[model samples]
Target: MVEANVIYVLVAREFKKFVRDKSRLISTLVRPLIWLFLVGGGMSRLVTPELGMSYMKFIFPGILGMTILFSSIFSSLSIIWDKEFGMMKEILVAPVSRFSVVIGKALSGTLISVIQTVIILMLFPFLGIKMGLLSICYAVAIAVLLSFCISSLGIIIATFYDSFESFSVIMNFIIMPMFFLSGAMYPVNKLPHVLQVITRINPLTYGVDALKHVLLGDSGIVDFPIVTDISVLAVSSLLFVAAAGFLFERKK
Candidate 1:
């Protein structure tokens, strides 16, 4: 079969799994809402107006980043599931290239993350976060790039573990630090020199910075140039996919 068909099959299978899990679907739709309200509500008073907006508004882009972060990364858990249940073995031994398998998994995560991001975007109006159509379009564009980049990263990580239990343990150690360091909740410049270097290296930091550029506009909170964010994510996605493909091929 064609690689396109492989990607389609994998994407559809994941989509079906996603849809059938009502709890996950609800949680995915609700997680950002909780953060925006529960966390953003309390933090707003403590936050300063020098941010050029309310704290909730200031963190809207970050909330979007959070949505993509969790959704894209966890979607790769399907690989561990497939591996344990014997499905992944058949897939790896198939005539298709391992790159096709990796692309299939990456696209599955990307699709789910993008859907969750759009759901979060729909809340912008309700939150008094007025954005034009082009801004929304731009935000979605970056979400796609970020989602693919993150999903590729997740795939690379998933290749290392064959069990869901082990993967979950490792994810806990990595995910929170990645979010906190990504400049999602605070400015990177305010961080110490060590943290500043770490955030610069995080793909999500560039992604959130890109979201700030497109969403916050002249909020003056952006770190890197928009081109830098896109370049890093784009290049990283390719390299990560290549790495995941190589890893998957080696497992054969």
Candidate 2:
């Protein structure tokens, strides 16, 4: 009962914070839409790579993965802020277990990311992309998994950083590199050998691959099995969340 209450309270607070941020609410959808319309559309004309899928089709799921990845990682900044403001210490002293606190935060971030994903999907057909009704279920499953995995990663990062400013610097240093290398905007095959190797290690690469297969029904040269991708994400998320809990308890 206490663990449940902890999760419920954390999620409610996180949702309220999201609602209060009007600019963030708008920019979440606006920035991705602009990229899809202006940048992705223009680049489609120039790059005629015969990947058995239209440029827009290929990039759509990548952008979707980008949404979850960015939202989850950025969510860690909230944790850093809470720490700086001494709210984290107050929460730490609550009756709930540290595991509950960490996992609750991860789940809250995952929910927020999935909401952003729905907005992104609504704009897909507007960009001349079509997906079957069944694909929506697949997309949701993939998004939720990606959200869990990414949010767990955020918790891991939150354990390391003490302030939002330091976290922002690390975000720029870490998140963008991961995004670009994840094949979110382009094919991994076209990248250099080192980058290709890096992509293979990136959890987001598997996510984009899995989502592309499910959403766009297109997987390029990459033949990532759905089971393998899902298993990797599930395992990684569990491990990361456990590590985050351990780190947080030690910090306390």
Candidate 3:
């Protein structure tokens, strides 16, 4: 009961901080919107009808992944900010278990990512992607799972960097490769053998593929099994949360 209360307090604190930051909220929406409209629009011209879906529709899952990826990972920046301002130390010295701290942070990041992704999801009608109730529910579930995995991964990464600058550099290096290689923008099967292997190994690829399956249904390009994708994401989320907890406990 005490641990649960600790988790709730920490999560509530994070949400309050997120809500107070208007600029951060807007910036989070803008990047995914730009990619969905501007970049997806331009690419739609060159992409052939042979692909069976418009580029906009094709990249929808990828854009969702991008939204979740950026939101989840950047959420960790709060840790660096808190540390710089000594807020983290105050929390660290509190009576809560390190596992509670990690879980609370991960859940908070997941909630933020899901909120951002839902905003993107609302633009689907404008983007020409048709989704039903079941699809929307599945997408939300997948987003929640993926957000947890990515957020936990972010927290683990955050434990290593006390400075925002260094954290930003590492995030940039990690985010792009993960996003591009996730087969979010293109069909994974069509990629070269080596690239296909790389995408297969990337956890984000499964998340994107799962989203594609749920959102686009039978029209989705990626034929990756939904069951497999969900299993991998669930396992990955557990692993990442455990890793973050372990790291947080050892932090100075």
Candidate 4:
């Protein structure tokens, strides 16, 4: 089969799996809403607006990034289950290259993440967050980048786990730290020196910053630089996807 056909088959299979799980679809939107209402609302009064942004606008992109990040990472967990059930072996035995398999999974996860992003986007207007056509386009681009990055991260981590329980523990340890350190809920400058270094290293921080810059208008969040943040994330996504392809191919 042609490479494009292989990609289509892989994506279609994954999409079917995604659609069959009603809870997955429901929770994808619900998780972000919880964070927006429970966490954002609870802490809104505490924030002093030091980041040159309003509380609602500042958190808007962060929550969006958070939704994409979790959705992608959790989506990757399916690989472990596939491995245990011998579904991964079946796919590996196919004529398509292993790299195609990894790319297919990542792209499918990204597509689902994008759908969740759209669902969450409807709430923005309700919250009084406004965006022009150009801004909306940029926001979609940022979402695509974030989904690719996090989905690639998930695939890389999946290569090391043999069981779902182990994967969950590993994800909890890594994902929570990344979420907090990535300036998802607060500014990096507010972090201590040690944490500042970690935040700088976390790829999610760049993604969040890029999303914030696109969604909240150029005038917002003037304190933290955005150009370099975007650069790092763009580079990281390519590198991560490359690495995931390599690792997964080796497994085959």
TM agreement with the true structure for every prediction: 0.95, 0.93, 0.94, 0.92
lDDT of 4 at 205: 87
Q: Which stretches of candidate 2 lie over 4 Å from their true place?
A: 218-221
Q: Write candidate 4's Cα lDDT for 1-252 as tens digits.
A: 127776788778878978898987897788888888887887777784665545665787789888888888878768888888899889888888877788888888888888888788667776667878778777888788888888998999998887887865876789889888887788777789999999888888888888777676676463357778777878998899899888886742
Best-first order by lDDT: 1, 3, 2, 4
Cα distance off (Å), candidate 4, residue 4: 1.5
Q: Candidate 1 lDDT, tens digit per residue, 1-252?
A: 238988889899999988898999998878889998899989999985767688898888899999999999989767887889999889877788778888999999999999989988888887677789998999999999999999998888888888877865766677888999998888889899998999988999999999989877866889889998899999988998889888877844
TM-score of 2: 0.93
Candidate 4 stretches greater than 4 Å from native: 48-54, 219-225
Model with the higher lDDT, candidate 2 or 3: 3
Residue-by-residue lDDT tens digits, candidate 2, 1-252: 228889889999999999999899888878677777677888888774776656776688888888898888777557888988999988987887988898889999999999998889877676566778788888888899888888888888888878776855776777888888988788888899988999988899988888877766644445477788888888888888888788878853
Query: Candidate 3 regions off by >4 Å?
Result: none
What's the C-alpha lDDT at position 112 in model 1? 95
Q: What is the lDDT, from 0 to 100, of the residue 143 in candidate 4?
A: 85
Top-lDDT candidate index: 1
> What lDDT is reached at residue 94 by model 3?
86
Error of 3 at 160 (Å): 1.2
Quote the lDDT for 162 in model 4: 74
lDDT for 142 in candidate 3 is 96
Q: In TM-score terms, which candidate is top?
A: 1
Task: Tell me the spans in candidate 1 whose CA falls farther than 4 Å from its real position.
Answer: none
